[model samples]
Target: MRFALVGTGLMAQEHIRNLALMPGNIVAALVDPEPASLAWARRSLAESFGPATAEIPDFADVPSMLAAVEADAVIVASPNFTHHDVLLLLLATDLHILCEKPLCATIADAEDVVARSGGRRGIFWVGMEYRFMPPVTRFIEDVHAGQVGTLHRLALHEHRFPFLPKVGDWNRFNRNTGGTMVEKCCHFFDLMRAIVRAEPVSVFCSGAADVNHRDERYDGQVPDIIDNSFTIVDFDNGVRAMLDLCMFAEGSEEQESLVAIGDRAKLEVGIPSGIKTLSPRVPLGAPKAVTREHVAVGDDVLAAGHHHGATYFQLRAFLDAAEGRAPVQVAARDGLIAVAMGAAAEISAREKRVVGMREIRA
Candidate 1:
């Protein structure tokens, strides 16, 4: 499939690298606001594949490029703020879309995408890559298989070291980025929903930017956004989940881990390494482990890739759907629900009350 990628930041380069390495796909052209980023993309393509690839300065002006390239799909890696507009624009074309997570900055825009996308022949997939992780996929399967018996509770911890975007970049500010929860933790919320396979009945959360605000990293100019949060979610099946996120942790490895409990057994998934289990369903008291092997650790799929190799799987899935080989992996509705959960967490933190899921949808 021919691809046109928008945005040329770290994640974009990672995607280009993976796409270059993968078979049956080619990055026909790249569009970015940054000349350097575009140059880097071209160079990266040259280094990996060859210099035969063409490059463009901006996707905003890609009508001619689109006409010339005949791209089968467009990958939107722009910041959270521009996601909706770019997506809406791309949707106007016949090109299928594979966009970064959160879908849009607000629920209204999310609904716009949903409303306009109805009955479209092309597939629109949000990049909620965790759903593609082997460990996460297996964990969900084990739970549903009764290996973990009746689901009980879940706990998720996600930490990153002060994700301050480029100062001039729109995403560095809260209003533009859709808050930390929506911009970053939406993946986790989506994962939680998928793992539980139940609707989120309600959510209560508490958080603040207390730590990052004081850190010198912000240059005394912190965005009006919470950098840390503790949220409790109620699932329709009587399952409860506690999620903690801290963006100020100083660690070489991005901290991400999940613990799921059930009547029969338990599962713990550690990102970047593998998954470890302590299942009573096993013959002995010992636990087994499952690792992500298809893609190398720290490969674009894990670090910059978003939830292991989800980026690759997501891209492939989008291509498949675009080519009528499969169905949408993550639909617009799922994207909205994930965004609503993240937004509700922020509202819960501010209002000092349980922000019900209904309020989010409403």
Candidate 2:
């Protein structure tokens, strides 16, 4: 399968690298507004992939780029705000799209994308790499197989160490980038939906901008979106979920962990790692010392590098799904759900009240 990477950013470079590793995928073309960045990416990709079958060409825009490149798929790795425009142009083609998370900037665009691309020949795969992790996959399997019995409640805490980009900075501020909810924590929300096996009923959120929003980090012009947020989601099937996202956690390695309690067994899936079973041995009056077993993932996702091995897994899965070898792990439908939750969280924060998912219209 041929791929036209829409943006030449860091994520795009990671996609190119993963594509190079895949058997039947190639970076046919590169697209970006910045000429210098595009040129650099093309040269870097060519060198990394060895002598390419065709010359690498860069395009300034998507329409012109698609017109010139004979690619079967396009990886829309552009900024979060530009997703709507980029996907709008590419959805017309038969080309499959692997868009980065938070499908679009708003719920309206996400709904529109879903409606427009409903019966199309190509598939829209969101780059929610966390879903592709082995632990997450196993957890989903266990839940489906009745291993965990009836699900009750789950809690997720996603903490990211401060590592915002300095150049062309919209990521640090939430105004243009859609804040931490859309820009960063969409992965956890998507995972919650997947594990819970139910749609979100209502959501209530509370947040503050206590991290990296100082005068030194703020560019003076950008608005301060909350860097820390806590959200509670009520699921349809009587399952309650709590999600906490923090961008200012010190001494944390962008850590994310999920604890799902069920009637049979409690599950714990550590990000960048595999599943661990926590036996239900309630502590006694004397404080019971409880310890059973812990199993780590065999795959060296961390050693594979780049955002805890998600970039590689997500890229490979997108290619595999396109080639009819495997299913798309994080489909556009999942993307829409995630974006809906994020959008609802934003609304809940603004209104200072519970926001129903059904009320969150396009």
Candidate 3:
């Protein structure tokens, strides 16, 4: 499949690498407003794919690229704020889309896209690649298989270094990236919804910009994004999920830890490393037998980079869906809900109150 990839930043580089590895997929066009990013993309593509890269075209913007390129699909990896416009333009064409998460910076924009996109012929796939992460996929499968019977609670924790600087530092502000939760935690939110198989009804969040990027100024503007947050989500199905995020922690064996508790069993999984554990049947009596099992993901998906090897599988699924061989695993509604969760969490944290998901939904 020929693809016009929007944005040539770090994430785009990963997509470029993965696209190159695919047998018939080719990046036909690169789109970005910044000359430096476009130039970097050209060099990176040339370095990665050698002389064949010359056949690919680079554009200063999406509209011009869309006009010039004939592609089977477009991958929208542009900044969060630009997703709405970029996607609207691409939706006019007959190309499938694999859009990055947080479909739009705001729920209003998301609603606009959803409304305008009604009955569109293209396969609009949201890029919630965490759903394809090997360990995460396995964990969800196990939960659905009744390994963790009747899940009641889930906790997802992330302890990592501060946000990595983006191509233009656009991610440092909520206006551009839709807050830290939307920018970073959307993956976890999407995961929570997927694993629990329920819609979040309300969120209570506590967050502060206590560290990371506070002392730094970009274009004379101090970053306002919160570096840490704890969010509690109440799902419609009576499942509860909590997210704990810390951007100041250092030297961790794993970047994320997830625990799911059910009526009959409990499950724990660590990110990147893909170490998983399951404890079946807590002792109700002193003589009751209980068992614990540890499972390690055998594949080294992380070696390929980008979300611990899930990108490849995600792209493959997109390709399969586009080819009519499979259904889209991550739908546009999934992306909207993830964004709503984040936006509501941001509001809840800022206002020191619980925010309903309906408050963000247009």
Each prediction's whole-model lDDT (CA): 0.76, 0.76, 0.85
lDDT tens per residue, model 2, 115-199:
7776767877888888766666666676667655688988988776764673366576665566677777788888888888788
Candidate 3's TM-score reads 0.95
Residue 297 C-alpha lDDT in model 3:
38
Q: Which structure among the candidates has the greatest TM-score? A: 3
Off by over 4 Å in 3: 284-301
- Candidate 3, residues 178-219, lDDT tens digits: the string is 898888889999999989988899999999899788789888
Against the correct fold, how does model 1 do in TM-score? 0.88
Q: How many clashes (backbone atoms < 3 Å, residues ≥3 apart in a chain or on different chains) does model 3 have?
A: 0
Winner by lDDT between candidate 3 and candidate 1: 3
- List pairs with backbone clashes in candidate 3: none
In candidate 2, stretches whose alpha carbon ends up further than 4 angstroms from where it belongs are 51-54, 217-219, 273-275, 281-305
Residue 4, model 2: lDDT of 87
Write model 1 residue lDDT over 1-362, tens digit each, in one string: 87888877777877887786568888876777667777777777777677566543345345655666677878888778888877777888878788888898888888788887767666888888877776667667767787667888989888777774552556556688778788888898998988898999888988988776554434567567778889899999899998898887757363677788888777676665664565465556556543333223445455444447766666667777888889887898889888888888888888899877877675
Error of 2 at 199 (Å): 0.5
Note the clash tally of each candidate: 1, 0, 0
